[model samples]
Target: MTEISRRALVQRLVASTAFVSGASPLSAAPAPNRSPPPPAPPGKFEFDDVVRRARDLAAAPFEPVAPPLPDALNKLDFDAWRDLRFRPDKAFPIGDSFQLQLFHLGHLYRRPVTINTIRDGIPTPIPYSANLFDYGRTKLDKPLPVNLGFAGFRLHYPLNAPKVFDEVIAFLGASYFRVLGRDQRYGMSARALAVNAGTEAEEFPFFREFWIETPESGADRATVYALLDGDSTTGAFRFDIYPGVDTAIEASVTLFPRKPGVKFGLAPLTSMFFIGENDHRFSSDFRPELHDSDGLLMHSGTGEWIWRPLRNPPKPEVSSFLDKDIRGFGLLQRDRDFDHYQDLDLAYEMRPSYFVEPRENWGEGRVDLVELPTGHETSDNIVATFQPKDSPEPNKPFNYGYRLIASLNPAKLSPNGRTLNTYQTTAAALGSPEPINPGSRRFIIDFVGDDLRYYFSDPQLVEVVPSTSQGKIVRSFIVPNPHTKGFRAAIDVQLEPGQSTDLRAFLRSGSRALTETWTFPWRAS
Candidate 1:
């Protein structure tokens, strides 16, 4: 399927499972099983137990269980599917600060995922029942299956206010899940794995079952484990989630590949870049810009910081940054000004940026950025992930760990000066009589930081360094921007027709660097 169709399908699935308000909190009976077998002994369940299951599954041939939806739900539309809302009164209380809600299966979400609650190292299945939901306005032609299971689930906590519980994280479709910080709206998502992403034979690895551990009564964090299954691989995952002003999730993943030489993208991030400061192709909208993430930020092993501005290319584009023992990377929404987006309801300015800090050494790998062509703002089209130099041996355990931070504060992620804005225009200055050269482009990059303020007094001491892979740099210089209290780097480049260039620029003061390297890929029409 095309990227557009894939995104559209996910959007529909997400809309069908959005949360709805309930009347009051009420306690319900223990979730009855679907004639389940005897439960495992207490204290026998742990991370190793899930790993054993993944290994056994990988040893066998892959079996898909895409059961057809019931007639009552298969024909339902968006609004109809959304009407099957899980009762908030039925929310499972994990501790004093956390509660869990389930999603009903319907619409584009046809496959069912098994959910279990782990207490005292004992797992209990949460069965499906019509009484668990309130189907409003939609008439059911037949009763649903007892083993219908769930589409996915979400966790709630007091993130913003003390009394009222707000949604902190949600796992709804595929191997996709999104988390939010205090005061931030949902934006991008973090996936378990991406197999052959941005290619015709791309595969999606999904979580077939989940085990959520009940935290202690006064505990501040929750632990959830998952068993992932795909045609290419089987894996186990553990998320120790801490929700607060800056929500952090410590993730431990173990993958057992089913086939040899299959490309895998670990700790993948998926987002949208419909329009942004660097993309000026679409200007008919009243809002100036719309995007979940504006750029890809990475810290290489050699201690170099690079920021690549995202673009909505006319065709698919993929860029890879080779590294060794990589430190960290993320998709960031740096433009927090509300005026820049002119969007009130969506609150694009309040979207959180997700940064992934590796907990274990990821040796000799490349961070890949995939930008798919997108015409609408609703569907996500950007993906970033880390691919190792060597593929994991089939049916063997491949372990990795990372900390995923979803925060609104982007400054703490890096210490040096960061890219403030990136603008592209014609080579000729505005209102100048110089003939327009369509093949020539001028890029202006502004950087801001505390260290840059010290250089304001000696602006001429800072130099602008620009480089291009397939173009000639006509001119490059640095100038002071009094308004932002920073310096702007401007570069003019001339490119041959149909030629593409990978451009990079940074600022330096004598022997010291002042800002992170700003990179962008440009193609002459």
Candidate 2:
């Protein structure tokens, strides 16, 4: 399958995004003599100062920066955007371990964020220079505006090897940013804030300004602060990143809602789930699987671990898992076998899964999961976020925070064993001696962990607890799967035609839970 470029995908999404309440600078005519923004908030800038700025911005009407970029630069396409590359020596000098690289403005990215470098608690603006970038083939016969700023910036550090800087994280496009580990490529994205996602009138917030601090020499972490603005809300966000085999970003957010009763989704994750092991809609394709993530994994507040396999349903499906004090949740790419995808160019196996761990006490909320149908793998159709039970009223203060970790093996993310594989078949001929319930479907869920191995020595010691929301569980049994060297829970259930059931299963022996509960919504075919 021919996939679209990431820039093209983001640009398309930006077009669909709803950012109102404020006049956008994109459609505004450019002023010939564009000058730099009238200086930012004065004095030594700190975390609380950023929060104060967000509050102050929320009190007034939004004013966008006027652009002076030539129409020629504004009309470039994806190929032309790719041609404009930042030269190496132009990397921002932050520290010995990390350097910053900026993204050039293009048709896809119109809004230019004010980029500043913070040192000794003071801010200094980074001037826009045409000398910093090389315009490969897009011949710009006219001189561009000297005040034209950048779209966004990416962090480059020696994540893979010593003395070699590799891009570990990037902040670009409408409140969207992506992270990568040592050997992983960018597949999924996490947004700063989501407003009315999965609804008719969804809003996309924008990061209009950024303050990247110079990291201490030889330190392992770097801190970046941002000022966010949108039609519905304004906020301040601080991100602290530690890059390695598994990159972890500690994010602190404070939201100021302009209008009351606006739904807010904190730490939202967006990914692609075109097809996977459970779905055969794309069985005729060259690759067996096409997805950035195949399941949603969560560690609830009550210490119950749940794994919900992803699907491109016939219609838009949204599920909410209520929690009192949510621990963590994330969209996971569980299957890691190269043979599963068989694509040499896009190594689906190397895609990183992001987990959001709550830092403060989230009193009560529901982790919302949204799955939108898609025909191709290029479009991201899956979105998940934490919806608080009670939102702060308009003109009130709302603050939340989470730690985001980008990794491949979520098995190490929590203490409980995880679901290794899951499949549902129409026929129930395997593992059953006699013809059991008529029209009953079969399910095989494999789990592997330390707790399971302790009980797998004696298969009878394990029990499969299966339950359905509105169906009859004909039978349930547990057996040791030699393939995974773990316990496999086999279940049979019968549901009438046109009926849908929410099924859940977990392995246990006596009072001990062996694996996380595997849950799925099934519709009888």
Which number leads on lDDT? 1
Q: Pairs clashing in candidate 2? A: none
Q: Could you give candidate 2's per-residue lDDT for residues 1-525 as a string of tens digits? A: 011224224323332332211110000111113232223345667677789889998998865543545688678888998899999898987877889999988767877788999986688888888889998997888776656878899999999999899999999887889999889988999989888776665767788889988766898887889999877889999998889888988888888888887888889999999888878775488899999998988877777888989988766677777777777889998889999999999999999999888877787778887776677888888888888878768788788877898998877675777898888875466585776555578888998886777766788988889988767898888789878879888888888876777788988889988788888877676
Q: Rate the local accuracy (lDDT) of all candidates.
A: 0.83, 0.79
The digit string of per-residue lDDT tens for model 1 on 1-525 reads 121125534332322222211111001111222232234465668888999999999998887767777877777777998998989999998877799999888777777899999877788999898988999988897888789989899999999999888999998878889999899999889898888765655777788899998877877788889999989999999988889898988888999999888889888998899888877786579899999999999987777888988988766667788888788889999999999999989989999999888877788878888777677888788888988889999968999988888989888877889998999988877799988776899999999995999989999889998988886998888889998999988999989998878888889988898888898877788
How do all models score by TM-score? Answer: 0.91, 0.90
Model 2 ranges off by over 4 Å: 1-43, 63-69, 430-439
Residue 18 lDDT (model 2): 26
lDDT of 1 at 234: 98
TM-score of 1: 0.91
The alpha-carbon lDDT assigned to residue 398 of candidate 1 equals 95
Error of 2 at 197 (Å): 0.8
